[model samples]
Target: MAHKVFISYKKEDLQFKNQLVSLFNQNKVDVIDKSLNDIIPSDNLDYVMQVLRRDYLSDSTVTIFLIGEHSSEREGNDFQGRPHQAFIKKELQATLFDRENNSRSGLLGVVLPNMYDKVYQGTSICSTCGGTHNIVAIDDSTVIKEFSANYYIKPHNKCAYTEDDRYAVLVKWDEFYSSPEVFIDQAFDKRKEPVANRVTVYPK
Candidate 1:
């Protein structure tokens, strides 16, 4: 069940990205790397997006977003005429877009080590369910919000969401690195599920 995967991450997380790539190679993982290596030299935002969608993301089955400390910061002004979101934002948008040539890809968020403590804050008693639940703190970026919002159709009470309720599966870097296939497979399976239809490719 080899899958073509596209990785979306901020420039600061290059080392983690490289480590993930190296891990893939070392494990002889059956995953195809379709991540962007060289920057596309263009001032036109639309052109850059077109190239990314058509070339890098068209065939990718899954998109793994590496969430770092500053991943939510807004940056990038490559588009000369109009204001635009960062490249990572655009990349996730493209990955979620369902076109004739490219269907929506399964989305996975990998929290980097730098933000591990912030993201995973141990367990807490759920006020609503009266059960212990993991306190996961994800960024409030529009891109992240949009995907997460659509994914949890039926939350496990007001306090938490079970893994089955999530459309975009999230994992810590270490957990993901330890067993990449399991997460990738989980993401890939989402594409065929009913939740796939709930995704808003371009959230306003």
Candidate 2:
């Protein structure tokens, strides 16, 4: 089935975003692009967010977040006077918000090449489980932390988070670009899957 997808990414990652979209086109993948192309034109954050939620994100079935090195950097302050990557955060929040007309989108995190080393290091032996586990560096930003920290349910082993445990499926750029549909389908399935119940759309 052709799924309408919205891409959420920092401006710096536009190149990769273009490449991703192009890959979909070249491969004849069944994906409908719902990403915002033009700027909102208004400086009023609230108004801009309203337009984003109502216009762009309302119909998207999945939101693919491009996680780069600067993706987690807090740039400006929101209405509450707290620092944040206002646009990205708001976009993700809107994607996660379910309403009468709009359902919560399935979330997918794509780690860019620049962040590959930082996010995924070599495997290491887990002290808790005595099993080799992927050494992942996830403390890049509060945005990532807020969304991904809920992957595992409470009282679960930190060293044993399988793909099924994650509310937001994450993949490296190359891996995703190789077979985009596979991951995209996985994300779209989350909408009606049990994992969707564990998702926290709004940040604390």
Candidate 3:
């Protein structure tokens, strides 16, 4: 039997998400997206939670977050301010808690390769990040500096919830996305590596 993976992401990376879904499908991995359900715009947070909870506990064995530059950006409008991160946090917390009690699998975090360096400040896009599992960039300078600066930040800290969350971070796209084999190896066990004083890109 094949493994079913569920993807939870912000709407900004619709194109990339489709491409990724295609890639995973080609590899014979069963992938599903939460947004496939015709969720109405007027649905309240509680309704959203109900939907997420159902999918989170379905046949899906792992939840992968398709992270982009603006994955954690919080936006507000006149009528109601959508708390994307906070709501996602709640969903994840519920899923994890349920999985822990019911003996289901946990989640995975896969980030866009070099998203932070490539995105601009005013980009009107949102990203999706799993609780922690993430991909790193090979040549992003800010990622190296920030990861070296601090191991972890509070959930509400700017570093953790920035428009571009991969700043000065530990993970690099080059290192993680070198090949499918590398991705597989890290997917099973993601460890925090020591930040090299000088970042270097190796020729593949």
Candidate with the greatest TM-score versus the true structure? 2
| Highest-scoring model, lDDT | 2
Q: CA lDDT of each candidate? A: 0.72, 0.73, 0.42
Tens digit of per-residue lDDT, candidate 2, span 1-204: 877777887778889888888887887664445443364765576677678778877777888889886677544565888655667777778778777787888888888988888878899888888999887665545235545554444445556777777778888899998888888889888888776777776654
Residue-by-residue lDDT tens digits, candidate 1, 1-204: 778777887677788878888887787654445444354866555577778888877777888888886565333344563323356667778778887867888998888877878777899987777899987765464235544554555434556776666778888888998899899989999988877766766545
| Model 3 segments more than 4 A misplaced | 36-42, 73-79, 99-104, 114-204
Alpha-carbon RMSD, candidate 1: 3.4
User: For candidate 2, which ten residues in a row score worst on lDDT?
Assistant: 30-39
Quick one: RMSD of model 2?
3.1
lDDT of the structure predicted as candidate 2: 0.73
Q: What is the C-alpha RMSD of each candidate to the true structure, in Å?
A: 3.4, 3.1, 12.2
Candidate 3 local lDDT, 1-204, one digit each (tens) = 355665555577677667767777677777665553344343465566556556554555554555565454323232455444444444444333333333232344455764655432233232443244333332222222112122232233432343122212232334433443334333322212222112221110
